[model samples]
Target: MKEIAKISGIAYLMIFISGFYANFAVLESLLDINNPSITTANFINNHSQFGNGLLGFVMMLFFDALLVWSLFGLTKSISKNITYLASFFRLLHALFFGIALFKLWNIYQLTFNASNSVTLQHRVMKLLLDFDTLWTVGLLFFGIHLIVLGYLALKSQYIPKALGLLLLLAAIGYIIDGMAKLFMPNYIDYKDVFEVIVIMPSVIGEFSFTVWLLIKGFKKQRGLQNAKFV
Candidate 1:
């Protein structure tokens, strides 16, 4: 089990890095800074036709898939106490990914068709809004899963408790941010601290945890390897 956990964690971590980098680097680079919305709209209008953005879209699709895969591996590594919850969360994650994939398809249509018709743009915009709604819900589920999984890790002797604690804190921040975004649009601008407090720590903690898991695997402390789900 310990060995499995280590290997799985490493895989998850690698995919996480790949997905995030593709978005932040390739996708973001393609966007125009000055007129982000218009530029993105145009990009969608243009490349989406002959699948110009196909590569990027596929890459983004893989991100969610990787996330789901990682979560599954993480859940398997942990105790069985929360196995059901973990599975549930993974399902939610996959659902969100599906939603995102559909949205991307719509975006492809909007971009390639280039009708420049207000009605079409409005329809695409509505689809985009629906995608955002699903994404936000998925985030909430993801956050909850992390918090619970982190708690499990903290209690276990296999992984470091500090890493688990950091995950928990990060989950809190995500939940808060999601709630604010959903309920209070006006408060969106004030979430700088929230983003910093949650995102940076999470990236660091998860990165460290991933590295450690890959390199050191898990310890045999407290007979964790053979223990049944508590």
Candidate 2:
């Protein structure tokens, strides 16, 4: 159980860092709405950005596969059905992100084929937007996974109840925010509020989990009785 916790924690941190780098260092730094050519220029000149961004998603898929299965293994004794369902949702989220990476690849290909044309620049920008939309779709599955995981955590005597509650709050935020983005035309009007109400909870929940898992690991107790570590 300790070993599993350690591995899961490490993977969690890695996923977080990779995601941060991809979003801020690569995308935020390079992408410009007014001059999409600058974006293309960065992709062509500094291929490392493209490579790093793609690698982050790939690493996420790899680590997430391990993380989800470990979670299922740790909590399945609580409810095998629910554990399986949560794992499935998480796996689906990974699959969605995996497909989204190809959209990035498509953008990269455009850089090589056509970097100067204004129409192509507009197309690239649109593709970037689409990529973000696709990632949000994946987050919907992630939200479901968190909800189930939170339930299992709360039910498990071996885990902290507060952590479980935080997970649930985070799940609610993610689901609501993702749905609003997809369905609500006026989503932009309330985006900042949504970030505060919904996204902040997720960050707190996940970060707390990561820290606890890394430092303390799962609490060993009688409540963990019958829980399969392997």
Candidate 3:
């Protein structure tokens, strides 16, 4: 169980890193008004954009699988039936990921035909806008799932309470940010500010939790082993 937890943790951490670069450095630059100069865009397009996006998608797939595994592991670690609820939320989480993955695929398709044609550009821009809308809705669902899962983790003795707390905070931030984008799309781009302040901290917290899990596994593993010995 410990070994499995460690492996899952490492997988999730990789997912976090790859997803961050893809979203922040690639997609955000494409959409945000605060993007760098054309030279920077050229450098990214020439050097690492496709690779990063592909890698991020692969990592996210692995992360989804690992999250399923972790849900089961948490069930065993805590010896509780509430993990059924956790598992349900995990499924919702995977669904959210699927939506994002589909959007990524559309973006990749658009990349292939990127040219100075007005029609193609307009179509691509519409796809991007739709992608943004889907992502916002996905985040709302994902955030609710996280809050429920985080509460379950907090109640369990195997995982650290800090991780659960961070997850809860992340859920709250995501909910607020998603809603703001949905309802007040013209409210001074609070989404950008939320990403820097609230979202980044949540990412850091999850990163820390992943590192801890990868390094140490769950706290109850050794106790369970000792109990077996006795």
How large is the C-alpha RMSD of every model relative to the true structure? Answer: 3.8, 2.7, 4.4
TM-score of candidate 2 versus the correct structure, residues matched by position? 0.89
Clash count in backbone of candidate 1: 3
Give TM-scores for every candidate, taking all chains together and pairing residue i with residue i.
0.77, 0.89, 0.79
Model 1, span 1-230: residue lDDT tens: 46555656656565566556644554445445344366456655456332534454455455545545555555554566475676577568657856765775776666674654666656666665676677777778878877877877776666678878877876787688778767886765675776686578667767766776777655544655543456
Tell me the tens digit of each residue's lDDT in model 3 across 61-137: 67766777775664444534555666666677666666766765665665563543556445555665676777777
Candidate closest to the true structure, highest TM-score: 2
User: Candidate 3: misplaced stretches above 4 Å?
Assistant: 32-48, 76-81, 219-230
lDDT of 2 by residue, 1-230 (tens): 77778887888898888877777777777876567788767777766677787787778778888888788766787888889999999998988887887888888777763447778777778888788788889999999999999988888767789999999999999999999989999887997888787768988998898888888766554646765432
Best by lDDT: 2
What value does the lDDT take at residue 114 in candidate 3? Answer: 52
**Which residue pairs in model 3 clash with each other?**
none
State model 2's lDDT.
Answer: 0.82
**Which ranking of candidates, highest lDDT first?**
2, 3, 1
lDDT of each: 0.63, 0.82, 0.65
- Model 3 residue 194 distance off true place after TM-score fit, in angstroms: 2.0
